[model samples]
Target chain A: MKKLILATALVAISFGATAQRYFSKTAHIKFFSHTSAEDIKADNYKSTIIIDQATGAVQVETLIKSFEFEKALMQEHFNENYLESDKYPKANFKGKGDFSKVNFAADGTYSVNVAGQMTMHGATKDVSAIATIKIAGGKIDGSTKFYVNPRDYNVQIPDVVKGQISEKIEVTVKATLQPLK
Target chain B: MNKKVIIIVLLSIIAIGGGVAYYMWNKPKTNAADVKPNYILPADSLGAAFAKNEDSANAKFVKDFVALEIQGVVDNVFVNEGNESVIQLMTNTPDYAVKCYFLAGESVSANKGEKVVIKGFCTGYLMMDGVQMSKCALIK
Candidate 1:
């Protein structure tokens, strides 16, 4: 009976160790487009992020409509013409990295090469970026910057303002994830 | 005389176009105070609806662009990095809640477990997360 009890306790401990998942409801994700004619940027603060320490897996979801642009006209054009947020309301990324070297118990920063598929505007594309993961006070702060060409995802820019909006948009995502309850 | 009228008409059209463009460029973001909630219900029901069928809920709320006023027990309240008030309302579904994002200047005055009503535009439901509401305002 004691042997069985010990075996059960071991299994329970292993399960606990593997469930190192952190989540954040309000992550910040910003995208910027720059051109000689104009510079446009939008910010989305309602992004949801989940990071798993065990598998080095990360998932992010942001509502396209949640992205707030400074100019209402720009926001409308982005939603109606560029992104079509009504049809594709959410943008998501699911990816993993080699985080086996990072010591979660210690406070430090680790850089990992992440490869993920980003789905937005009813299109999916592979994306790779080097993400910085910082561990501090039992929380994980993750941030990554990457560039994407809207043309790759079939985001058509009208001829009238093609020069005003840059083809490549710089996207930055940051989240301070807390331990999942 | 006809040529001069044509010039005046063309100039008037150009001036009107420029004025419209200027007004649109300077238009401000939507204020939460001006929105009327299209759907008023318990927060738990809204979460459960999304958990049950995300597509339909998303169509009705996010795609259709309907605002919502949800009332429930406050799970927690905090300010995000953007200095916007975020209030989480408890739901029946496990690991899911109604997250309401208030405008930048709106102050949230709700404690954990306090019952409250919040109105906002439903953005969408993230898988494994709860429904997101933006530009939220405290109705009571």
Candidate 2:
């Protein structure tokens, strides 16, 4: 009986370690803007995420000023005036979801929603994001997209130059989530 | 010699005055039509719809444009502010000048005696000097 108990404890510890192992740093983030006059796009969001399997939790963060625009001045104004990257430099999304329910015997599709606080421009809002995970060849792929507005975070503009900026800004995310080996 | 000096002075004065007049005549001027019509988010207004209090009644009520007849200062221009509003755009282009993109809202003036229609989004604003604006635009 003691031998069996020791074996069960060892298995539990091993499972804990396997569930929360560190992952390789390889993920991508992008954003796009559309307007009547022009459809401008910037894809330079550097992102990082830390997942804790034991606690069923995850944390994701990316810089706003990293977005590259066609014009340097607009980029400057974007960080300084619009998004205020100086005041609110980073945009973060951290939430919890379950990963243990996978029916590993047969590979298939699963949908999950991560509900947490998305902090941007110094404002923390409760955001529920959906993730579509596709499993194949012992690897997992994930993707998500959402929208944001400048005014929500207190980024303000004056009246004189108001015509140059759009009302709503679109933010999108795509990443290849891989488990720790 | 005195008479010649006086005559030269008079000619020089005439030449300087003529040049000044010509320069003034050729400088770029803006008429009411030259002042373009566009959207501008007001400095004092409501915030965006996607805001955290996104469901708040105030956010939905803040209109994008305010129509009226008055003079206001927009980029140092003094024209009859039209019924259409003004809004600002976010850009890095070299003063694509008036090619500014705007939000839909209204605003107070930087100065007086200027006419305009300000269009912009409402946003919460707080400054180090205790200045606050409920709605502000990202005017280019």
Candidate 3:
């Protein structure tokens, strides 16, 4: 009985030591497109992000339909024609980065480059972006900006409105992560 | 005579198409404040559904763009990066809570621990976060 109890305690301790995961549900993502005719932008605040401090692995997933546009028709067209959100409901990014330079025990800001595969509209592409992360008072704040081209993702835009939409769209991400229990 | 008729028909079609394009570019969105809620429940119930099965909960509550009137205790009230007021409601789980993002020009007047009703469109459940509602309006 004594040996069994000792083994159980050891297992528990090992599990506790491996709890180095942080997560956030309210991450924000904004995409902006600039054209000579108009500037189009949309925001999606319901994003799921997970960061493994031990392995420096990061994953982010968000619903495509959650993006809100200024105009209702524009949103509808984006869903029905451009993105086909009904067919492809979510966009995700998975990658690994180096988090060794920053000490989680200390509060400070760190800049790191994360390379990952971004999958959207049923197409996947390699992407790398610089992330600014701040650890303050037990909370982690992170933000990054990247550019994506719709053509690369197989998103076709009608020629009639080609000049009204920019070829490259700028995507910005902001998240506040808390230690997962 | 046939060529003249064809030209008039083509001209009318072009004019109609232009009018439609103009309207689509300027269509008004549905105001969440004005619509009747499809579901009126406590915060705990909604949270429980997602906690039980996230995938099915999303299909039922999230995809349809259902308007909800959720009553719960205010956990935290703060302004987000966009300067929009956000009200978080307490749930059964500490890690998950319902967050309501108020529409622009709307403010959160409720204090923490106070019970209030918020109406908005349910976007979906963020895996680690609780359910999210956007364009929320405070109900008196």
Candidate 4:
């Protein structure tokens, strides 16, 4: 009976060790476009991110309509015309990186390269980015920046306002992840 | 004289259209303070619904910018990167809570653990853990 109890304890401990996934629901994602005529910026704070400490895999999901612009008309135009967010509601990224260089148990900052597929507006593209990850006081903070073209995601701009929007949009992501229980 | 009149009418139409477009591009936003909430419930109730099924909660609360009045204890109060005040309300479940982003220049007088009612536009669930509400106004 004692041997059986010990075996059960060992199994429970192993299960606990595998539960090293970190999650953040309040992550922020901002996209900016600059042109000679105007500069447009939208912020979305409802981004969801998960990072597996054991495997160095990361996943991020963002709701397109959650992005808020300063102007209501710009928001409406982005949803109705540019992104068609009602049709394609979400954008997601899944990537893998080498986390062997950093120790998850220690508090420090590590820069890593993540390569993944980004899916948005019913189109998927391969992307690689550098993410700065910091572990401090039992929390994981990460930030990254990347650039994307709307045309690559099947987002078309009418000729009338083409000059007002830039071809490449700069996207910035920030997250403070907490360990999942 | 007919040609001149036609040109004048065309120019007037173009000018009017330009003015309307400009007005639309710079129209004033709806005041959240004046709008009535579409739904009212406790923060725990909303969090529970989202925890149970994210897709359903999103369909009901997020598809249309539904306004909500949620009551709960203050879990955290902080400012975001945009320098906007945000209040985090605690729920029954751990890691699942209501995050309220207040409008610019708005302030909350409530401290942590104080029960407060907030009204805002529900942006739906953030993953399986959080309910996001923006442009929030405290209703005591």
Candidate 4 Cα deviation (angstroms), residue A12: 14
Which digits, one per residue and each the tens of the lDDT, describe model 1 over residues A1-181?
A: 9999999999999867856877887789999999998899999877888878788898899899888888878888888788898788889999998777777667999998999899998889999999898998878888999999998888988899999888889999998877775
Q: What would the per-residue lDDT of candidate 2 be over residues A1-181, giving only the tens digit for each residue?
A: 9999999999999776666432322245666667666666765423556555566676776656445565545555676777765455457787886655543224677776767888887888776667665667767665667676666767687776555456666666655555654
How does model 4 score on DockQ?
A: 0.36
RMSD of 1: 2.9
lDDT of 4 by residue, B1-140 (tens): 69999999999999999999999989865535667888889999989888888777767776545688888999989876666688899999765789988765566677999999988877656555577777788888
What is the CAPRI rating of model 4's predicted complex?
A: acceptable
Model 4, position B112: C-alpha lDDT score: 97
Ranking by TM-score: 1, 4, 3, 2
Which parts of model 3 have CA positions greater than 4 angstroms off?
A1-26, A45-48, A84-89, A104-111, A122-124, A134-141, A151-156, A176-181, B1-24, B27-30
Local accuracy of candidate 3 as per-residue lDDT tens digits, A48-145: 89988778899998878678888988888888799886567678999987876666666999998999999998999999999998989877898999
Q: Which candidate is the best by DockQ?
A: 1
Docking class of 2: incorrect
Q: Which stretches of candidate 4 lie above 4 Å from their native place? A: A1-26, A86-89, A104-109, A134-141, A176-181, B1-19
**TM-score, per-candidate, Cα-based:** 0.88, 0.50, 0.75, 0.77
- Candidate ranking under DockQ, highest first, comes to 1, 4, 3, 2
Which tens-of-lDDT digit does each residue in B36-120 have in candidate 3?
Answer: 8989999888888878887677677764457889999999998866666889999987556898887645677989999999888
CA-based DockQ, model 3: 0.35
What are the RMSD figures for all models against the true structure?
2.9, 19.9, 5.6, 4.5
Model 3 chain B: worst 10 consecutive residues (lDDT sum): B57-66
